[model samples]
Target: MCNFKLSSSPSSLLVSTTKNHFLISPQPSSSSSMDPQPHDDGLHRWPTPQEALEEIKAIGKISGPTAITGLLMYSRAMISMLFLGYLGELELAGGSLSIGFANITGYSVISGLAMGMEPICGQAYGSKQMRLLGLTLQRTVLLLLSTSVPISFIWLNMKRILLWFGQDQEIAAAAHTFILFSVPDLFFLSLLHPLRIYLRAQGITFPLALCSAGSLLLHVPLNFLLVGYFRLGISGVAMAMVWTNLNLCLLLCLFIYFSGVYRDSWVGPTSDCLGGWSSLLALAIPSCISVCLEWWWYELMIMLCGVLVNPRATIASMGILIQTTSLVYVFPSALSSGVSTRVGNELGAGRPARARKSMIVSLFCAAGLGVAAMLFATAMRHRWGRFFTGDEEILRLTAVALPIAGACELGNCPQTTGCGVLRGSARPRIGANINLGSFYLVGMPVAVVLGFGLQMGFAGLWLGLLAAQASCTVFMLRALTTTDWTLQAERAKQLTAATNNQSSPPYPPFDKQSKAAAAAKVASETFCSGDTARDGCSIEMEPFIIIVKN
Candidate 1:
């Protein structure tokens, strides 16, 4: 029989056995076990060095699809702009203004909602909790649907709002018509956001890129035929928008169903996965508010600018510049999505060091893309104006603004990528607050003061806006640079584990028979010397023997 001894010292205990080796770990007291244990709070918490490098590489690979999606989406937007320009100044203004409004209302809201899914789904995916992933998607879809009704109402009543802006009857009428055609598309658009988020969380991004590419192909021809040949004007543009959104939604749905992800045993709804409706609402509301506030600030700026100058040419020029800047924003926007998904996943997997490394890689990549875009914008600055209109005065004025436009790209890339990093961490409120303070509290007032009070016109207003964005970029970069990845990883792990229980075991420990069988075939053996004629006796043993003496 093995002999076991109790030691006076509580911390150290030893057991002596004749055969097998044994390990002893001191069990904590009941009170100690019940109490919280101190956790590692270092700068990074990747379990191993190899894991850190693997995460960075994985995140880097995932960004390709995101970048492609951004490019496709940008192409669609540009094509729409091109179509609007072909229709004449009044139609261009009307189309541009209406598109701007719908985008702020619909696209921005969808984008925000999509962000809500990243942290939740990314964590779930990282933890390998497939069921929780499906439930999160379902919950997001339900919440987004609920939010859509209020937005639809807002879209329907947009004309009344435009009337308050002092828009002429013609512009107001065109805006109303465009809105009517566009509002119904929100339902389809809502589905698209959640679907994109779901695929992205799984590190599957090519589907969105492919869908966007397909939609753009169909969108261009439809816009041309409806607006150019059919003379549908603003209505044609609205129709094209609807068709594109519908196509995107359908394609995404089909891909999700066919990918077999839905049918996979690891994925789908579970008892604990559904959670309370309130949990989803809690996340969604803040996310929505954050996005709405940011978009609304820009809309407010545009409306205020419209009323500040006479002949409305000033507003039109500003709209042109906004559209131009938005086109270049696609690169950073894609990079941001890539960062959020990758960072959230790594954090959820309890790899803080990897998350930090991925963030750095994303920022560097985004900055490189930003530099290339700036160069392109600068080189093509003079030629770009002719694409929008034949007006010499508009072209001349736009040319003057090119350098500043290029400068804005520098700030835009970092700010957007920063937002993505924050969103992946489920910290949209921070981004929202930063945008509000920077744009409204500082940027807007400065622009208004320069444009009207100082009588410096549109250039002054843009200059002030640029300064505000630059400030925002600085603040965001600082926040990203100084983020505590260890804390982020812990939070990510808790959230992911809560949502999906990926850490839970599917089977319990082995039974007694299995344990005995495992032990019997590998018996302990020893060689000993006792008494022999010429040499020590050779001993054969079934179990290995270990001798200890004190």
Candidate 2:
């Protein structure tokens, strides 16, 4: 009879077989583990063509489906809006107000706070700290659920708040009604955000795309059933919106159960998740602010338009242009999420060069996408407005603003992707500072001057955005250029190291003398193999870890 033994660590696994008194242990390839890539020439040198191509493929695999998934999710909101339109003008107006309010207060906050999990989950998976992934997910879900409570109270008082702000009584009451029905969405989103990040961190994307697409396909029919057939009115529209997120969450849960893809990382909920709030909140607050600062800027623009010379036309045209930018934003946003995962993974794996390469490749891709967006907006300028309206004044204003908005995209895409790089590097606070400085300090001043002081009107408001994007791009590029990939890799190691220590080791820790001996042996082997000159194979490499069984 033969005996078998198995052992694993972050980097590799050992499988042993024995017959009689003989034993053979085989190890997996280094490339398949957390081992650094062979090249350790540092981050300055450009990646070889093969490396660049591989990085592109990796990023594309995540970004392609991610882009589709984003569009599908965005379409859910569009469908809701369309159904509201079908209900009549009053319902449309009220629903639009409520949706916008929810976005600013509820959805944006949820999305931003959830981003705090990205770097942690990505790095945890990369470093093979599988338990940390589950812990992070659970902690994030708990955090978001807690956050939703206060937001719920805010939603509960929506009418009084809207009325206090001097909004029309009828519209405020309508908005309150719509918002009241949407409270359930806050809880659903709490679960959905962490779940998506948990999967995406592990290079799981197709399922997200698949699930989102399936949900969106059902969204329209569900809307019809509730609003048209049940005649639930605006309440039906709100409920349909809530139900879409709930459906997506359920689908994702079912998919995970059926596929068992989460088995490796998911240790199931545990008491370990109860702590670790501060670490997550540190990242989450800045991420939330960074996202909100950008989102609220556009909303601020809308408010500014309302006070313009021709309020109706300006606000209408602004709405159309905002929609145009939203459409253009989808690709860059996807690229951002993809790069964040890639960077975090490489860094966590202690492959600084590979992480740097991911950043470079993603930046170039974002630039290309930005240029394409600019050209598209420019090319479609004459006719793009017709999709939303045929009023000559609004159309003309939209046509003029479209190209400027496109120019903004030229800067927007790269900056957005750069933000992702920052997130992956666990430096969201830096991105937040940049946004706060650029948009509010620089862009806002420029807008006020151009729009009112110089009397450039609506176009001036867009030019302000152009100024903001340009400044933001400059700063983002500077940040990316100045990044210390080696330092980031060290940080990633530290971040996951704590969690690994908290976990039960598969085997006992090595004694001091044994660890020193093992280190010496590994160093000698690496040096003799002509890897001594490389940064990774030096004596200061990671401590040797192993598991053995008799």
Candidate 3:
């Protein structure tokens, strides 16, 4: 009989053994997991220059492809807009209105809801809890698909809803026609959103970029065939959008199948997915609120612009500026996704210090990107509007508004990145509350005061946006700065371990073949390290399991 005792710091791994069985648990390390228990000379120090560079490299690997994917996705929307513009102002206005409605009601909801799985999947991957990752993906997809039903119904009644809101009848009818055709998009996104997060969590982003690029290559051609040659008009535009998404989904499935990325995790749908939704909902609802609040604000600003002194010029300028901010948004959005993955992965692996460092590096990177965006916006202010319109008033107003929008980007980038940090740490409720306060409570009143009360006109409305971004940035940075990484890491472990009440045991049960393989791998890695005590082991922790050597 072999008996062993284990002890370690709160952040360090522990090991115990009994009757020829070894158990390993998470512990702090100096270098990497392979060199656990090295000297801790600078345990809590800020990352060194070299370490910072390495972190930058790691973040770039994730953010680079993520940015490309984002740009490609943005281009799809742009292409659709261009097609609408070509059809005439009525078609463009109606299509744009319908798109805004869809975003607020459909796309945003699905996106935010699906994001609930990010922290879970990312942390699970880091903790080597492969089964939890797959199960979470399935559960999220089920939740999104269920969510799409009501959203589809809302889209079906788009004309009624818009008419009730006092919109022009002809525009409302056209909007309805477009949205009616877009209903299938809701279900397709229900699946695509989860799959993207599923792969993103595992740092498999290059494939996403590749798939998005492929879909985009087909997007223009499809739009041409549908909207132009086929003479389907607005309906055709909607169909092309839906088919493009469906094509992307098919491409992702093919890639996953051919690459066998699902081998380690996917186990097919089970009864487990039917019941364990509480864990997902906890994160999903707040995430939905956070995303929707931000998205709705922009749409709200567009509405507010409708009441300005010169409605045509102000509203048109607002649209162009909105597009400008959105374009600048691509980089920070990618950075946010990257940092979320980094922080979640590090914490899941029980490396609190590394997680903190990742957050720091991400913030710095966001700041730099923000500066660059600001400068570019300022320099291109005079030229950007020409690409959209030649209307002297709209162009004049756009040039005046571009600089302010640039300033907004300066704050927006960091706050956006900070939101990702919060999400990665499973604190989206905090981000939601902060957004509510900053946008509604703080920003909205100022916009009303300046734009209406003080009569600053369009610029005043933008100033309100600046105020919101500033407050959001401050609060977001405060939240990130005060995070407790160790506690977050512990929480990650618990989250991945506890799937649901009716689910299988805390740790996924392994089959005989897998058990043998895991045991062999553990033995090869740990026993050969010369780091195990005579009766104990220094093996890395699995979320929960116990194995006996043969």
Candidate 4:
């Protein structure tokens, strides 16, 4: 007679017997047939059709709210710019420059960090490692906070940076003042980012939407009171930003507390799990550089526009184009979030096939939307530029730029969606590198030569940008299409198992009896490096051999 001992760890189950075949008896209500034992470890377990359908529904539910929130936030910011323009050209130019600086320094960094959280949280949630999910959230917060110090110092020196870019004295002074009032926002914004990401990871996006709407509602009236009525000018815009962020931070914190998501077990300092300050920096530094590189490229383009004839009008018109395009981008951006969560969750759950399917669906949806936006922008080209300005010359120039802008939307969908897919797979470096190559190596130089060297003006400049975006889209699509889901699934499974072992003790060590049971469990789970090699489970030893053995 053979005996079996059940182990405590969910990853490994032990059964002792002389027989070669193990029977996996289903529960009384389960309809599964009694046959060869299936995998007992969690990695190889697949979601039921019902579960997949639920996930898809959840993705759909959040998309609309996400889009609306993005639209509202951006619209409020645009309204601020419009109001500032009414004061004077100097005020308008200064406000635009300062806001650009603040966005690149504050919002861009927060958004990038928030992007990193999606994959980590989604994976942890899907793998059923709830404690690790909490740990990841804590670590991300610590990481963002620690980095805020250096970012603050950089903001303190904003005058010098703008001077280097050849901004006149008055412009530099306005930018410096705004930086002084706004630099501290980096920390506040950083705090808000993790909270937003926390809600997003749980598939609860409506709260963020509501909070954004609340901020928008408050920002406009406050802007009118400060800049228009009080004559605080640029300083008023700065104050509005500060108060709005504070409001958002407070609201989100309350939401987290009230939702009971931050109980004693989940919420606390991460000093212990952080492993040390170096670990946090290791994740954040690369991400910071990545975002800076992308934003700086656009900043460079804007600077180049300033060197052209009618610098003020050139910059202003381009600003309108940028903001308008950004508004349209809300759709693709929302879809990207959906893709990130879906792909990350599926990958974490060891369902690479499902992850692949989700990516395709997301890509198709994004492409269809992109086409629709292109048609809409083209049809409205004559009237579209009037929304930002009424100057006949500016409007005329913008009309010519519209078709190119509309065409640029075609590339937006694939590139943004591909970025989301890569982030979900915990491979942001790949997307970052692609952007660097496409924008800097290929796109910028073309725009410079055509716009300035050839004197093609704004038309030439946009053509250059369009080329870059198209190239990026092509490369990203190829990358997405070529992903090897089977390999990804194996890697994900190994990573999850290793994380599990580290967090808790293994049920049995590699003794004769334990090895036999471990081998059986691994086999049933299809735990092999290669997709083939049926019936024999092979545990990867490269990354976690020591940890697994220990």
Candidate 5:
């Protein structure tokens, strides 16, 4: 309901960021050598403070709801762990290990894969390519289902894998049990992630937050029955997750079916989806690499803690500590998703400078929120662990790690938001390159040496994570600063128009009359004489599609 339309008033259109820059997209001249006709305005300029505030509100309107949705989802995981903590140290430790494995291998993978939708769906909605949205969703679902097969195999074999890695045998067995039951949640997430992106791109986040909240509210009681009453322990926690995810997925699907606001995009599934598969795959693969690299680094750090001195206390404490970081992280992640939607939409709408403005606002917001998270976590370090467990040792360990988690978040918030900017600009590969360098090339070596070689243990691992985040932040800042805004705007227009050329109607207002005018206008134009053609001109082709299309 907080959704703010970009042009709040007719006067605002000129006073603020107007859609004017894109009003007269030149019809491509039929000549093969024709160049895109230049417009009076090449790109939008930065908005005034009042205009920036309105657009920032537009971003936050999406962010506020998605942030709540993320919080609900985060709470579901933390509650399950909180319940496990109450059960005993063994269940907590086992649940922690199983969760780490599932996140690194399953949820993170699916999440990263789903990010492929941000650009496609966001740009489609921005460009008003309504039909492309539904087709993109179909293609995404197909790809996610295909990827889940191998991940499922790995989850089913997690116990053996953990044991092979010399994990505590009992913890390994319990972790395996938890992951086995959690496999169904993986498929649900595949559907959920795509839906989340599609809806957010349209600035429809209230329903998603509503649905997730209801299910997450139900999740608490379900966890109570499974873990507290049935005594299913960590496996029971996994069952609760499956149900919670299914509830959210089903509700969003139902909304899309009945709301009719998004119905224009859904013409039912079709083979037309196959056409976009390669493009989606191209975006998806890099997105997965970028996101998973960062997600896996942290989860791996937790797994490494399993081999440290007093493994049970360290792992159990991390189970809670990781949840804490995840809780605070939702704010930045939501900002990233929010800005991705805004930027992609703007780019799709052929407003590159508008996208640039949104990115700047998001970075400032992330920085302020990150600083707040740091201070809160630091202030609560000594007392915060009591919220999860009564074990004095677990509490002590968690307290020591909380400060480090807090500091890591400062770098992480902006880096995460920066990735969103890259995704919206259709440059996921840059993020992948940066992540590969920061986490794997630099962060991992530091973590390994400090955690084991230097015998610094848990603190050393946190330091490693901190260093990786800082490195990533530096790269993202450079990417943001160095990008060419005008070129990106041109690319945005081409991609949007190109997509509409293949898929008709809802993607563009170039309906019958507009089409007739465009065709007739081009049909009236002519190539220069053959002698003049030598200067730089070509004959028009039939149907009159401008070859040098803008």
Candidate 6:
């Protein structure tokens, strides 16, 4: 057995440099898998304040484009509410309710599962395990498409389900009409979302921003032509978005496959893609839970509003409030994605201190964005709703809800960023538990009590949101404070370097078959010297080197 260390503290392969060629065997990290052995070189220790600031600057470089991408995504989600609200109170209320339902049953699950790809791809890219990114993408695409089949049934029967949930019959009918044209949205998202994680992990975000902005710019005119002139009603609204998303997806694929920007990440579909089903599912299920719990809860608040007295006014108010908060939320969420990628990449490279510094910087960024959003909401509370509707009651109710939503952001932003830290660190189970406890165990009961028992209506539901966000923030902070960054870095190393939960020897014996021999031949390859900072380091028999990421 050969003892191979993963950290780049040494410049060359662990084996004797003088040897021309040799078969190398590597073992699992250690018997105590959860504890990382501390090194005295200071590479993995806590950072100084200046170092933290520098790390933040690096994270912001990536997050700037990421933030723009998120803003565009928010704009896409807002089309229904913004356009439909202008149609009539009935359309706004009905459209908002249906969109909320679609999110819960369809988009949330798909998006959550896509998050599993974050750690996988981020770690893969960081460690130079370029092949795994393709496998992760293929496996995720398979899972999402399979999952979408059952979710399609829910969208089909949405009208009846809303009626069973005690929604007003007219609102339910209008909601049904909107959902009827939304089926394609589910299928398109299943593909596009996983691709997002793959690209973000490789730090390829600007194209995403460009693609989304172009789609958004085209959508406005399409909305006008279809809904404004053709008078296609809600179906027109649904078609406008559906076609736009489809075009965006196609453009991204063409850019990736043809533009050479992502050439190394994707190698056409392979046999290995079909083999990692169970391993991928292990991370994916928890990731789905972690993200879906938070996303569904936010959407659930809108649904809860529909059952209250003066349902139209309350639902419309919640609609404006939900879209407004979502638009504001794009900032923190974008930072979260950036940090997840940065932390995972550093950890995969076995740089614990960098990952730790990334987390601290993200928390501070979230804090700053939260303050700006709160002030903006406070200033615009009376007028922002004018963009969505002319009704004074809806505008007033929306205004009443803005302050609370803004306050909620103060806590919500940090927790959201913290969740990203968890994802990048391959610790989604912790996030899932925190979300389950905060949103369902504590916050749901509080919401019901305030909303129904006390007749607080929209205000009561927001108070519940605040409670949940606060609880989540406290729990996530506690988790972050206790995290062993060294251990997380070690885990990242293991994930990117290991195969099937075990480290693969550099020269695993190959069968005599032509395919196996060809694979081994390809494996014995190299690029630039195995420098820690350069991505060229990879598996090779000539000056054989291996690197890992978190």
| Model 4 lDDT tens row, 332-418 | 877777777767666677667556656766676778777987898889889988876798878877888878888887887778777
Q: Write one digit per residue (lDDT tens) for candidate 3, span 1-550.
A: 0000001122211223321112122221225522132124223567778878877876777787788888888899999999988888888999999999999998889988988888888788788777888888899988999999988999998899999999999899889999999999999998999898888787777777889999999999999999899989988888999999999999998877766667667867679777556667767887898899989999999999999988988988998888877777888888888888888887778877778888888888888988988898899989999998899999888888888888888898888888888778766777788888889999999999999999998989889999999998987777676665655666676666656335423334456676666455433322212222222211122221223333
Q: TM-score for each prediction?
A: 0.76, 0.85, 0.85, 0.79, 0.80, 0.79
Weakest lDDT window of 10 consecutive positions for candidate 2: 1-10
Q: How much is the lDDT of residue 160 in candidate 5?
A: 86
lDDT of 6 at 157: 96
lDDT of each: 0.63, 0.77, 0.77, 0.64, 0.72, 0.71
Judged by lDDT against the true structure, how good is candidate 6? 0.71
Quick one: how many clashes does candidate 2 have?
A: 0
Q: Candidate 1: global Cα-lDDT?
A: 0.63
Model 3, C-alpha of 323: deviation from truth (Å): 0.9
| Candidate 4 Cα RMSD after full superposition onto the native fold (Å) | 11.7
Model 2 gets an lDDT of 0.77
Residue-level lDDT tens digits of model 1 in 26-71: 1111121111222343244322445444434555445666667767
Better model by lDDT: candidate 1 vs candidate 2: 2
Q: Put down candidate 6 lDDT per residue, 1-550, tens digits, no spaces.
A: 0000001112112343443212111111222222133343334455566667666655665677777877776777677557886678788768877877887788878888878777877777777777787778877888898898999888999999989978899999988988888888888988899887887787666667778898888888988998999998877888888888888898788767655545555657766666545445656777788777877787777668868988879977886787787777777887888888888877776667667778887888888888888899888999999987899989888888888888888888898888888888776767787888888998899999999999888889988988888888888888787766766665566555542222233433333454344433323321111212223322221111222321
- lDDT for model 5 comes to 0.72
Candidate 2 vs 6: which has more lDDT: 2
Which residues of candidate 6, in runs, are more than 4 Å off?
1-46, 85-93, 166-173, 228-230, 307-309, 386-396, 452-457, 497-550
Clash pairs of candidate 4?
none
Worst 10 residues of 5 by lDDT: 1-10
Give the CA lDDT, 0 to 100, for residue 439 in model 1: 73
Off by over 4 Å in 5: 1-47, 86-88, 227-234, 307-310, 389-400, 449-455, 497-550
Residue 420's lDDT within candidate 4 is: 75
